[model samples]
Target: MRRLALVAALALSANAYPAQAQAVAETADPYIWLEDIYSPRAMAWVEAENARSLAVLKADPQFAGFYADALKIAEATDRIAMPRQIGGQIANLWQDGTHVHGLWRITSPAEYEKAEPAWQTLLDLDALSAAEKANWVWAGADCEPTAERRCLVALSDGGEDANIQREFDLATRSFVSGGFTLPKSKQWVSWETPDSLIAARDWGAGTMTASGYPFVVKRVKRGAPLEAASEVFRGKPDDVFVIPRTFTDGAGHSEVVIMRGITFFEAEFVRVTPQGTTPIAVPRKSTVTGLTQGRLIFQVNEDWTPAGGQPISAGSLVAVDPAGKAAPEVIFAPGPRQSVDADEVAVTQGHVLAAVYDNVRGRAMRFTRTASGWQQSVLPLPDNAAISMVSSDRASNTAYVSVQSYLLPTALWKVDAAAGTAIQIKQTPARFAADGLVTEQFMATSKDGTKVPYFITHRADMPLTGTTPTLMTAYGGFQISYTPAYSGVTGKLWLERGGAYVVANIRGGGEFGPAWHEAGLKTKRQVIYDDFAAVAEDLMARKITSPQKLGIYGGSNGGLLMGVELIQRPELFGAVSIQIPLLDMLRYEKLSAGASWVGEYGTMANPDEKAFWLKTSPYSNLKPGAPYPETLIWTTTKDDRVGPVQARKFAARMKEYGLPYLYYESTAGGHGAGANLKEKAMTIALEMVYFQRRLMDTK
Candidate 1:
């Protein structure tokens, strides 16, 4: 047997604290070697861990059956082809057993409305990967404004965040030889002129932030070398990232803006013109959505007390004049209980469409600019459904919107923004039987007398015996609302097996708008954890489930939440699944893309913040004698967004302390667990098998 702490070494960094206290608080983690992602020694350790975990989990009698079910569901041909209207054509990215990597295809709107649309493939990723002997995943494409024929296509290797950009011709349906090509890097590129593009990438050392992101923006001419690109703007090394923004309106008016991201939630927008660059009057914590009728529009993430203007509340959608450089005009103000969950501002030939959420429920509105001000007309949509404006073009008045609920598969609606008319265009076939399943919402009281809402999905006839196998999850950060979402995988794999699913809408989410998230910011984040614990306890109190049969899961920020719960309330859950999470919060500032999130999570530079971190950092808190539930922790080698190093260190620390944990790290797949559908299915199957063993078989 391998001695868990044999390779461990601890290091202490004094950050404005007594040397003794700092020494006691910090340890040179032996697992720091794991941070060298592709190092042979680290990779060998990862391979051994993967094999050991797979041997046990895959040996289960239900493994093959679960894999088959998951693969079939994932490759189902009847699944909806989510469409986007571009250049008067309906385009979609599709994948199946035959097209594993996916096919970027297009069709006419008329044919797309048919039962089975005739799709013409524009790019076949699997074929390209096979030809190049490389794993290629589609990042996205930015087509030229007027013709929409030439596009800058971004492709990532193994689904990593770093991508290579190339110019492609839509007419020829092939990459444009001798056209624009940007070498592989984590970069942002926007269309400038027919022969120039505004870009920001690693221009060697000192060109990137501490988080490994580009901090310098430049103009790259058609055939010039990256070094030859003219400098457009440059941000400090401590700045999060810097990039150029190009806003083109329905009226064919175009504006270039320089965005210097001072932090994750703050930025400075300078409107670029032929004469020079002019600073726009906008709050630090605001995001520019698009330009409508030659006016710049943005959503405020923080309350704006403009130099000479009255206070504008956070979460308000405001518009400003780039020409006049005047005070922003509040286009739409969210109510005390409302937020723009899916902030959709699509400028059509004549009008703008906005989708707003009130208490986690969705609604769409039409905003028409008048001489007096902006007027709103709420579009007709079903209550309690999540609405998303998937596709719209400046040339057309019709926009594609999708509405879905927990039980209802997505239904595509073609909305005429000018007329405010929404007509159902298409829908997805039911992937699982929903006849007996029912969904209902409930509220649990938090520690601070706050009401936290949650949804329960299970059989209507479920007995309240406190023995039901339950899977509970939530993502309570980033102000992202947890609205009703349809998941056929859960329906078929868990619910059909007599399991229950619960989603908590707790603090630190946009469920109740900005106020909800503000309640749990930084050091005050304990309330967010308390809200989740409250919901779990509420379920137990209602006799819906007991600790023996309950499992919790989450990914990314939610993965952090799962790690916290595993340490704080181990007795409340039978199993915990943490995926692509930030576990070692202390050294997170030094990891890939971690510095950008300091605005959300307080930094350790402050003595008080360091104290909070010393107490809460999951990896550091793993004591040798504490009892921890058997946990499933997984991440991807290509996950540059959050870095798999944190997960690796956590698992290694758990091993050092002899805690029970199953770790799996894929060689590829970026921020997402997998680059292809098969990989996703395999991971899902493994998770299901683990949950079944802990929550169902044991029960």
Candidate 2:
């Protein structure tokens, strides 16, 4: 989510006349000048202006009574917890032209009753001026567990003036306040243990700095600082497992191991007992991954061939005992001419079940081991549908997999290992009527002749006239497959609004596993962009949509996609929505939380990598006199993943170049725009309105 203040400014500038552009441009930073003129900011300003216009409309006698009655109805129906009002909170207020402080709250039935008298007394003070009355707005409740039930409240005013501190006297009992400064820059901060807080801070230059897994515990009277009871290992910590007392080796040594991935071949396991930390070596020269109780599983590649200097092969699963005394045992072996990578493995009483994925076959296979040997079984697959195994419940011997296809919506299934059958348990429901919805599988040839798979969805009955409004979205990096799934708000707002939605399965994604992803990464980065462009061109050639009626959207790495496309083919899209994008490639390695992406996007530390990155980075490609699409760049200040400064500086430069775009920044809400469901819905709604209004208006 973009910042509200920037949204207000952009909303007004979006529709500003050419004469006003100069004035607005002068006041805003050059980096985002173009966005300031026609982005979400401009739209938001229009809403504000309309609110004022409605106030004038209320002055008329016919409208005055209607407005009053509407207010009464709104207030009467403003009960909490209803679908329409959940997570709703009073954001701001003004009185006598002077802003006043406000706080939000949601109280339990018991707490509400206790505060009822005080609230009524405050309301009964009708003798006070209207400014005082207007100063208050209910924010909402904090539903987190607490010893005493309490109402959630926020301090919205009293920055320097006003006696509003007294106003919170009744609410102070529920307040739990403490602050911890982060040791490094991170995209997110969260609490894992009941009394422990963990933050993932990004400090540019491929280095990640961490704090607070070892910090003081707050709000707990008896809790000790996490560092006191914690032990830091030499290598990066990947996972933690607790061994039972019964399994002790009787050397007064109970194994607690930390697995560190140094490379695909080498993973170091450091074991700690009552004595001290000891290094335990298992199989190297292979991909030793996955975890189960009392064992570190290794999957060795049958044929070692270096692709991009990374080992690639098919392998088996092997396990070593905690004592580190004997040769590892082969628990399961891959089928001949077929490689298996253990997606998940779980141990039961004297039995082990493993979920494996066959890259060569593009399907899932399962194996179970008894006292005798291993028994393998092939799981049933839905017609034309692919399965990606997520996890297995060893206790029940059941596995969970996500099934998807070009024509079918994504469904989650629980596979019964014993029966070798899959049971469809849940699926995303189509929010809008699917009677007219159609999805088609299409292929696009990249610049290098790489065949890219893509899916297109639109109104089934629409003509192939090349004039329909279309929105194409793609994320072709990080080996993350873009599965076909149902989105309620997106369906209602975009598809139902007569817009076509296309998802491009470009390289750099795990659609076909690691090889597919590696094809579009680092020096091959341009392949992903070429693939995305090919998809866009294919849609136009098929007469499904034209450049004038096409819109594009993507976030994070995908944001990089939008940025590149807007610069490379500005005429290809009518409107572009780039959320939390990484645009500044030159300085990206310098920003907080930027280094983590170096694996997917190579570090610019090397001149060659730097040159390639600069060639494709949208920020570096922005020209002074080139025409660009009307772009909306959204980001958040609390985004620990990708710093908002990238969007800020990009918008500033675009504005400097006199490009038309908008930059909206959310002051709160981490990497995402909203903190709750309603906020998320509102953000989506705003994007739909912007895209629909712009794309549908093309001639």
Q: Which candidate is the best by lDDT?
A: 1
- Give the whole-model CA lDDT for all candidates, comma-separated: 0.84, 0.51
> Can you give the TM-score per candidate against the true fold?
0.95, 0.62
CA deviation > 4 Å runs, candidate 2: 1-224, 236-294, 297-365, 370-374, 378-392, 398-414, 425-429
Ten-residue region with minimum lDDT total, candidate 2:
158-167
Q: Compose the digit string of candidate 2's lDDT tens values, residues 585-652.
A: 76665565455466577767777777675556677666665656667877655455575767776776
Over 612-689, each residue of candidate 1 has an lDDT whose tens digit, in order, gives 677666776666645567899999999989989999999997888798999988888999769988898888989999
Off by over 4 Å in 1: 1-25, 305-310, 325-327
Query: Candidate 1 versus the native: TM-score?
Result: 0.95
